[model samples]
Target: MIKECCNKIDNNKVLLSMAIKKKRYEALVQVYHSELYRFAYWLCHDPTIAEDLVQETFLRAWRSLESLQDDKAAKPWLLTILRRENARRFERKQFDYADVENNTLEDNKSVTLDDEMEQTVIHRQINKLSPEYREPLLLQVVMGCSGEEIADILELNKNTVMTRLYRARNQLKEALTDNHEPIKGALN
Candidate 1:
């Protein structure tokens, strides 16, 4: 009788632990899903692939949630997972590079035609940036990550991240200037 009682108590404890984990996972998803999706979209330039990458990233995060010691570290942690998941895509299979012009720009929010055209031009200029500068800039501008967080996600020193961000802004400015577009605080 005592052994059976102990077994029941142990089972209840395990169930309670799982419930806590589930709540934590759900909160994490709710808080970071949109940010993760936007970052992934910019990285791949494809909505479907971006959604896949975010799903895979969250799956990996759920599997390894126990290892994540700090709640404050969640953004950087999830971003790192997403970056790795994106890398794994190449390992799984090579995808034919699609021309940027072929892919339509999608935005849910309503904006004027001029606003949309400006966004398209800015996106094109950003795409022209080399990966090194582009990655840091996107993490900062798109993901709103700090220098430390960007460095942690990219596995680089903070100085390197800052340098890349500066260079990225300069390149983007130059590109827009060449196109005779006024710099309308896009980098800001």
Candidate 2:
């Protein structure tokens, strides 16, 4: 009778453990999936690949869920998983070089906002920035991560993250000003 009782208790403990894991995984999906997907998109510049990358990241996260000790560390943990997944894509295979001129993705269309065209210009300039500057900027601006979080995600020091962010904003400001100067000169 005591053995049966112990078995029941063990089964109950297993069930409870599974329930807690499910709850945590569900919460993670709800909170970080979109943000992770956006970061993946920015990294790869392909919507389909970005979706796949997020799926793989979450899959790996689930497999290693026990390694995650703190709730606060989840964001950086997930982002690190995602960055690794993106890097692995390059390691897997080498694709033939495609002609850049014929690529449809190169086509940029201008969208006017109150005759300003500011949004389109900014989007283009952001895309123009080097990946070193753009990645930190996107993580902070889009994901709303702190410098420490960004540093953890990017595997850099906190000071490096801050410095990159400052440089990114200054570069954007200068590039935008330079772009508009020609129009201002034409107007004059």
- Using lDDT, give the best candidate's number: 1
Model 2 lDDT per residue over 38-100, tens place: 788767767788899999999999999989999989999999999899889989965443522
Candidate 2 clashes between residue pairs 3 or more apart in a chain or in different chains: none
Instruction: Quote the positional error of residue 102 for candidate 1 in Å.
Output: 6.0
Candidate 2 CA-lDDT value: 0.81
Query: All candidates: CA RMSD in angstroms?
Result: 1.8, 5.2
> RMSD in Å for candidate 1, one decimal?
1.8
Candidate 2 lDDT trough over 10 residues, lowest sum: 98-107
Residue 12 Cα positional deviation in candidate 1, in Å, after optimal superposition: 1.3
lDDT of 1 by residue, 135-169 (tens): 99999989999999999999999999999999999
Best by TM-score: 1
Please, what is the whole-model Cα lDDT of each candidate in the order they appear?
0.91, 0.81
lDDT of 1 at 32: 100
For all candidates, the clash counts are 0, 0
Cα deviation in Å at residue 114, candidate 1? Answer: 1.8
